[model samples]
Target: MELLNQIKENAKKANKKIVLPEGTEERTLKATEILLKEGIAQIILLGNPETVKANAASLGVCIDGATIVDPATDSNRDAYADIMVEIRKKKGLTKEKALDMLNDPLCFGPIMIKAGHADGEVAGAINATGDVLRPAFQFVKTLPGMSVVSGAFLMFLKDKTFGHEGVMVFSDCAVMPETNDKQLAEIAVATAKTAKAIVGMDPKVAMLSFSTKGSAKHDVVDKVANATKIAQEMAPEFKIDGELQLDAAIVEEVAALKAPESPVAGKANVLIFPSLEAGNIGYKLVQRLAGAQAVGPVLQGMAAPINDLSRGCSVSDIVNLVAITATQAAG
Candidate 1:
């Protein structure tokens, strides 16, 4: 099925309230339109009201004024500040800092969700990754039973080499800089849950590394092995294995030669990396160099579905992430 179809179906089920920062972008406005027309969400757009209108007019897109939430005109500003101060009382927030954050777009969006004004948020179409994440940590928080917030990419491919055509999830690419065995295990299980929730399938997770099984010896090898053990213990129902190279995890002949006993080898859909460097570089290599359409660095393990978009993302990208965010919120 097409990724957009999955998104539309999820949006119908979730009916989430979504907040968009820097809502004047062509893609952002178009996404807002789709969300409303499809009943996928009730959206709040952030920016100057007139400016948003003018931009939409310039792009030949029209947004209902009632749906746009201008921070400058928001009557709930002080209330939002109070909520932010309350949530970050331990973070050393003073009344002044609280007010400052409430005025900031980054903080305001998540604060809206925390205060029940919105169900989820989608940002980073024109912001940095950290700019997107800082507010999420401050307000949205980690999901219950989850540790630190980590992330993954939903890689969209042209061919259905795997059971599902079009896309598969690969995670921990955006959050963890260098994950230990326990962290990797958490990433695997968390990603599996994310896949199941959004894509509606039990994930076969592959803990990918430079070596397969006992053929290689190093700290990294030990890390993958330990991660495999932890993942099995934490989510035994998930099909998971580790220390397999890329080819071995996804290719049939490689699985036969390298690690024939592994359940996930050659059949894994979600791939976990030992470090952020590898995850980021690996995914980019496939997307840019090896010819695949990479859709996300979707933030996971959060209390709600909050996602970041590339600054250069198109209207379609924003629409897709909003769909993903709605699904996350529904769960």
Candidate 2:
């Protein structure tokens, strides 16, 4: 939890504006009240102002410090709609359709970021992942020279000997069911950035696979190896290596035997899984079995930070992710 505390401190310094689309959602409202009290980040709640206040009052939480925007009645709705039209011109988006779309808080949140009204967004408490992400992908898109948007989790384990003082970053866990080598490379690079910016760790990335330096050969292993190469080339400044097994990535003895020549094998703090299925399974296993704290699926590689949340997330989870998003926006 020191990591989240640190993130909160960083967020306070950044003081970035972050929009919460699920303003009427209980956890989101509660988290917004806490964020407002702590001055962790500027809060923008998207909904009908009166309804948002009534919900907060009913829940005995005061969200007086937050900015409440009713997308349906805001003066900027016309401009946001026009921006949407322009962004979707090729898809033949109409102003009327864009205006109607903005009524959905999920869509309004991203459009706010796109128009510089807000720096980032956190949603998905009362929405599905696709609904939360579709507008983001359509509007915010990916960061420059990045064609992929991936999710990364900051894994904090009870045992201190593994990873960077027991904290490792795992990626593509909540998005990208499958990827080609190029997309995998982007995941690796983006995850490293996330680890550094959000977790405050110097990232030594390991492109993960079943094989350790080709001990066992397969197309999947080759994909990981190729991704490692591409990631290294694309980000020459970072220490990155791969086709490493999980043990080889974190165990010095296994790394010494399996990937002796690799700089990152024994010391990796960022793990880029070969697929979403693997990433999801690997993180959950460690979280439940090893008693590790899994903090994210922090959406990365977007032009602006727009993170998704699990519908089952707690108030603390929302607060922590908003802090992370603020830090990402700062970077």
Angstrom error at residue 135, model 2: 0.3
Task: Give the per-residue lDDT digits (tens) of candidate 2, residues 216-272.
Answer: 999999999899899999999888998899889988898899989989888888888
What is the per-residue lDDT of model 1 for residues 1-331, given as tens digits with 9 covering 90 to 100? Answer: 3666877787878787889987777788887776777777778888888888889888877677336777766888888888878888897887778877666777888888888988888998878989989889878888777776778888877667862455678888888787778888888899898888777766888888888887888988899989999999999988988878989988889899998998888887888888899888888987887577777778888887788899889877887788888888887
Give the TM-scores of the predictions, in the order they appear: 0.94, 0.98
Model 1 clash tally?
A: 1
How many pairs of residues in model 2 come into backbone collision?
Answer: 0
Candidate 1 residue pairs in backbone clash: 27-315
Instruction: Give the residue spans of candidate 1 off by over 4 A.
Output: none
